[model samples]
Target: MNAECGICYEEYDWKERIPCIGICGHTICDRCRISMTSKKCPHCVRPDAFKDKNVNKQLWDLIRFTQLVFRKHSFQEEEFSEDTKRCSHCSEPSNKLRVCYDCCIQNGLVHKYMQEAEQKEENIETVLQNIRDQALCGDCVIDGVHFQHKTEYVDSFIESYSRFLNNRN
Candidate 1:
């Protein structure tokens, strides 16, 4: 039997589409499968609690191939990582924090965040110097586009430069 698109309900020829079965046995066309957004079948909402070794390996292969396919399509501008941490490297939620694994590898976001930790340890001399020069305190965490967008402490930072320094301490 031919498969159908689960989302658009369009007819799909088996030759033109691939088959993927979730644990619930809901078969979906691989070309339009919801697996990219989730491990559980979107229809069943099962936790997908466990997986055998074979399934795990297949999943990894799927992820890599999908990432590559997405890259080719320019939709791969952002990466899909299993890293659940908000910030992955920071505390940012993975849902809120998106990084293109391809770009990150090329541009070194992983290394950059690693270096950011050391940035907080800037000596008192540097901190004082920056503050004296009417600049962001050396230890200040006020970096990234979030500051300009008025996130969290950024509003308060705009209120008082001293507040930025005090918070870093």
Candidate 2:
């Protein structure tokens, strides 16, 4: 059974993020299914594949059972763990936080009311520095397009600088 959604790469949760099978026999998450702008399956790109399809409950139950077993096993291992490190957010006995990446991002978002409470001007330098740090960190790069754009920009800048140096000499 496919434990994760191919499109979003998120584990199929028994709740809202349930697994669904398209008419083309490709599995996707419910959220992705709902947000689908096109009638085609993202995986196989089959036209009208997801049209009038519902969540595959039988498949989802199997995936859910597997996830439960894995989590139980992980907890059992954690019980025998000797590591002293605890998660900062949850105080869980682990090096990593228990919160999911999406939750962390959502929680980190600054609302308009919070921004108004601070009433501070945007620090461009700090923002730029943060972006630079994220871009240089290989793990933080999200999109191929973003990487390509940055690469092309840097290449163009280098070429221009080389030309300027040659003209000066």
Candidate 3:
């Protein structure tokens, strides 16, 4: 009954992480909702049951209340395990200990420079190969924002949720 989604087991947020309730009354996070296979409630296995899903406002309110309670209790900060922390790119903790791409680039983990002709002529495969060669974590090929374009390393909602969990002590 906490803020986590039963499907993906990720924490809910007020923005994109909002929870949705299926016709069968099972709640899932928006991420899972978007990835659903057949508009069916995964929990109930009812085909098309989730065609008209609604936002679980009550659960969202409960999450807010819980956040307020935790803040009121003055919970102590706790250390986070690698699994609980998210990657700056994909926002998933697939690899908990990977270094940021900016650091890698600065440290010469990848080629410092490519020829202008090569850079202009490079294909997607070449880019992917470079990303792999750099050994950057967080699915850079698929989900990474260019380092120059990155304003925030972590998702704000996930960061807040991590704080909430860590302060439970």
Candidate 4:
């Protein structure tokens, strides 16, 4: 059984996890599926392989079962504390106080910057840096890029930056 998402490498959670199976019989996470520009299978590189077919219910069931078991083991003895703080975008309790990237996007700052950057033909690094500078919180940087037209370029820039930082350490 697949334990983590191939694209983001994040462990599948019961809530946000939507496993999509490509026609080539490969699975990808929901985020990557949504962000994908081409309908090709990312793993097999097959053209027009992924279709809007049925979701992998078995995978989802497994994730839910794992979540239930884990929750029982991890949080059963702990007090259920609710976060009073709310997200700026969805207005859901954020649990931690932070700027919401979705909110920033909804407010038009991200779009404005993206438009200006495209017009200027700014380098990907420069565009990402500009966004980072204006970001009110880490989530703003993490989630905002997914909504941009230059998502792939920005993602590449972030990966490169992460590698640079890791090498420096």
Candidate 5:
């Protein structure tokens, strides 16, 4: 075997060689195997003969990790929306990346809707807890657009909750 890998620029050693077969029934290294991707062989780049399920698994794992970071920091965007926000991770401009529909679906976990839901829940809970704590006087409105008779406990609760939340954020 050659002493070096063409893709990784790593020196091919005896330890790096895996038991998998190339198209010519030659033994290749793990780095080469992954580089070949879904193809049957790194050198040949065919799809049918690369029988190891682990190869696909490894590829999926890589994509999954990338999808996570993309979703997290808005670096990766899926094909679901042409809008939303740009991803911060990739150097490529927003127009250049191939946004995948499947990846977009997976990326739904770290979306703006999720953030809005959390904020709504927090706001509702804050208001409810404020009512429970009697932070408002008899004349405080839950929504500023309207007025309601809130108890002393509710007033205190709202005050305390506001301080608690302000400190937390």
Candidate 6:
């Protein structure tokens, strides 16, 4: 599936450039959906088809997952690039990169959504499990990451959820 809107070719985002599902089951970006003179499916040209349509959660999840993977890969590429010096952590050519897990926990780097979910008595794990079960398919490639197993899907959901929470916070 394409990560961009068919009409404008803009990449989908969790924010303003969200993916919406038309009545005809075609994906449209939020911008294109709002810009239309009539509620029509931009891809199929079905009239009055996208009126009151909602964001497609599955597509949104996939896009977010792809974005997270892309970010991780980009960081890795920068770390291991030929021009950079080798770092002790990964033995990759990076500039003294070290992640302090204790510092992160002490600094409360964990976003507020997790606390909010706990306060609201909502089972975040269950929600993530459900998303993992329904949102991704078997051995699908999104963005540039090849998700060959269910664990990748689970990790994607976790990363996406963390990003969403971080953005909200």
TM-score of every model versus the real structure: 0.24, 0.38, 0.40, 0.37, 0.22, 0.41
Compared with the true structure, what per-residue lDDT tens digits does model 4 show for residues 5-110? Answer: 7888875553455677777888877667777898788888998766564466777777656655564321111232453433333332323333334543565434
Which digits, one per residue and each the tens of the lDDT, describe model 3 over residues 96-144?
2244445444654333345545334334444434443333334553355
Error of 6 at 142 (Å): 28
lDDT of 6 by residue, 17-66 (tens): 78899889998888888988989787788888789859999987765466
lDDT accuracy of residue 74 in candidate 5: 24
**Per-residue lDDT of model 2, residues 9-89, tens digit only:** 886765556778888888888888889999699978999888866888888566546645554332223343674333332
Rank list by TM-score: 6, 3, 2, 4, 1, 5
Best by lDDT: 6
- Candidate 5 lDDT, 76-140, residue by residue in tens: 33333554323223322243222222222243411222333355335646444323322222222
Task: Point out where model 6 deviates above 4 Å.
Answer: 70-169
Better of 3 and 5 by TM-score: 3
Number of the top candidate by TM-score? 6
Task: Candidate 4: list runs displaced more than 4 Å.
Answer: 14-16, 67-169
Candidate 3 local accuracy as lDDT?
A: 0.55
Candidate 4 versus truth, CA RMSD in Å, comes to 18.4
Clashing pairs in 6: none
TM-score of 1: 0.24
TM-score of 5: 0.22
**RMSD of candidate 1 to the true fold?**
15.7
Task: State which candidate, 2 or 3, has the greater TM-score.
Answer: 3
Kindly indicate the candidate among 2 and 6 with the higher lDDT. 6
For model 3, state the Cα shift of residue 59 in Å: 0.3
